[model samples]
Target chain A: MDAGLIFYGSAIFLMVMGVFIAITGRHLIKILLGIDVFDTGLNLLIVSFGYINGGTAPIFSKYPNIFKNVVDPVPQALVLTAIVIGVAEMAMGLAIVMQIKEKFGTCNIAKLKELKW
Target chain B: MIRRLIALLVSLYLGYILYSFVYVHFPFGERPLRGVAAHYVENGIKEEGATNIVTSIVTLYRGFDTLGEVTVLFLAATGLGLILAGMKREEEEKPEPTLIMETVTKHLFPLVLLFGSYIFIHGHLTPGGGFPAGVVIATGYFMMFIAQRSFTPSEYLLSATESFAGTLYVIVGLLGLALAFSFLDNVMPLGIPNRVFSAGIIPVIYIIIGFKVGSEMTGILLHLKEA
Candidate 1:
């Protein structure tokens, strides 16, 4: 009956869907996309846990007198760094994919099993 | 088919475990703040001179983690460059951009740049900060890449800006160590909160982060473009 339950549900759904995609998808790009979805779901879960029922943002200017009602800010700070690092990691994965395509001429996981060039 | 079904089952089980674990420990939206979050919310503004507690936590309380995070990004970009090195591209005929895309990009590019600058400049006092602002600046360059036919980011400019910003970040951290209690400590005067000039070393560190992230992101985008 709680509204927060809906966010929790969505986060779980995204994580499950990402895992499904990452495990079953043959294309390298699809797997990478799954990884991204997984990261996003984890981020959502963190931010959601930091939420208070009626609390405002932790910014002092927005709610000067909301000393007792501000939501947890540690999660928000951690999520910020996580999101940016995800971008860097995903970019690196794509770069490796590009190299694989250059040498192996395929993006499918099933076809990229050769060890030697 | 069996593999897909097995994967689905396994992931569903894992997801259930994760969800239940979180639900049991903290419940959803009902838990009260404790420990560090409480401390930061109470005295973060007064001690850090920044209206945004998240900024204070990221730049002051956990500055070392942020330093490592930035280094991770830099290393990722460097590794990306190294992985894609020495691939010669045959010059292909450039295609012209659509009229609407060209017109829109031309008009939107400068606005995006200005908005990105605004976000980073007032990071200590705003909701958004260096990372989002840096990505926005890179998005502007990305627009240029798509709109212009023969356009490429200048290697010299990007490297210079990235190096300068990264070096400044280290220097600021060292200054904190030399004058204050430890590395990345807030040593400078904490001006009045809710103002642009407040939050000593917080804004400075964020600006440096902004420039470094912007230049690195732009380079990554340009590097990944098909030649």
Candidate 2:
């Protein structure tokens, strides 16, 4: 019922939803979107892992004493790197999809099963 | 129907496992700061002279990792460029931008660029940092693309800026190794905290990262658009 449970619950829900979408989606672009959703959920879970009951941000510009109740900075730093990498990955994935469509003449996963052998 | 049912079952099972794991090990909001995180929160300012602990961690405490991250980003962009090359160029007709869009972009473009620079310049003292600032700068470029169909950014300019920034970043890190204790160390004088130029090498490195990321992202956007 508390904030922690809510954060964890939503993160898990997003992860499950993303997995379902990835499993069931037919289009290549749809599958990519599902993967992005999963990425978002994982990021949410990581940030939440560093959460404290009422901790503030880890900045010390204004309130120096807040470090006593500051949330963990390591996870935040990790998420920062993850987000930039995610953008790069998304761009690469979309580029590959474009190439696939160009060569195969379709974006449907079922139609491009020529390599199933 | 079967695929959907199987997917549902898999998702449900995965969700149950994750939920139980969270419930058992990580009781929400009660994780005490320990080990490295504790040290960072407590002494990060003293060591790095940056008000933003996360910024200090990203650019200084774990700076080597950030260098590797930047290399990965560059590789991804280069790979995308390689993949998109040699495609059959199709001349698709495009419509002109609306009057409102053109006018808004004309007025807003400079402000966005200024804001992005501000973000990266003040990274040590504020919440925003290089990545977000670079994205914002790229967004400005994206807006220009949207407003003008003929707006093709010069490939030379983008690559030049990106390479220059990246090289400068390495040079700064090398300087740190030569002058200070290690690579990417704070060789510059740790100026007054809460100021724009505080945190020694942190702000300089962030500025380099900002330009590098901005140009790289803009190049990616251009490739996707051209493709």
Candidate 3:
């Protein structure tokens, strides 16, 4: 019955939807999109956890700019790093997909198992 | 399907397992997130002279990681460019499409470029930092696709920007080692806080990162275009 609980529920729901899409979708790009959705949900969860009561921005000007109430820069920083890493990973995946399309002429993963064993 | 069932069960188990951790009676779980990040942040200002803790953390504490990340982005762009360049257009050759809204974007391009540079320059003091600023720069180049539909970027220019940015990053890092103790170390007499050129290596490193990311992303976008 709290605001945080509601946000948590929404984050979980997004994760579930992402997983469902990844499992059910047949298209390669859609699968990638589903993974991105899941990543976004995870990022949301991290930032939400870092929330504090009426927190000020993490800026330190002389005189203890904020005696208290600063949410968490760590999580935000973590999310930034995670997003950049995800871009690299997704780019590599897309490159492989492009190469597969060039060779097999189709993007469906099911049809991509030309290499037996 | 068995896969779905497995996924559902795993998620349910994870939720149940982490339920106590996430929903404790207290405002937050056991501790409030300062378990490991305290040592550096406690005296970061005294050392780094940057008012923004995030900037200090990014540009000082974990600079090597930032270096590696920029390298990763550079490598991805390189691999993607090679792949796209090698791709043989299989579809039938057709007449080129006419440029759409060329005049407007042509005028807007300079403004976009200026904005990107501004963001990168003030990354240490503002909300927009290296990565986002770099993306903005790339977006400036992207505007060119709209300005001149038949036009393509001169590969040499983009590569030059990328190399120059990359070289700047390494040279800055080396300077840290040369003057200070280690690579990427923040030496050079930490200037007074909140100045444009303060945070000895922070601004320089971020500017290089900004440039590298901008050039690499622009290359990637151009590479992905339908040739």
Best by DockQ: 2
Ranking by DockQ: 2, 1, 3
Clashing residue pairs in candidate 3 (N, C-alpha, C atoms within 3 angstroms)? none
Against the true two-chain complex, what DockQ does each candidate achieve? 0.79, 0.83, 0.43
**What is candidate 3's CAPRI-style docking category based on DockQ?**
acceptable
Superposed on the true interface residues, model 1 gives a C-alpha RMSD in angstroms of 1.3
Each prediction's TM-score versus the true structure: 0.96, 0.97, 0.86
**Tens digits of per-residue lDDT for model 1 on A1-117?**
777669888988898999999999999999999999999999999999999877888888853564578899999999999998899999999998888888788999898877786
Every candidate's chain B TM-score? 0.95, 0.97, 0.82
Worst 10 residues of 3 chain A by lDDT: A61-70
Per residue, candidate 1 scores C-alpha lDDT tens digits across B1-227 of 89888999999999999988888887878888889999999989878889999999999999999999989989988898898898656688777799898888889989999999899989998898888899999999999998977678797899899989988998999998999869999998998888889899898998898899999999999889852
Estimate candidate 1's alpha-carbon lDDT, on a 0 to 1 scale.
0.89
Q: How many backbone clashes does candidate 3 have?
A: 0
Better of 1 and 3 by DockQ: 1
| Candidate 1 local lDDT, residue B83 | 86
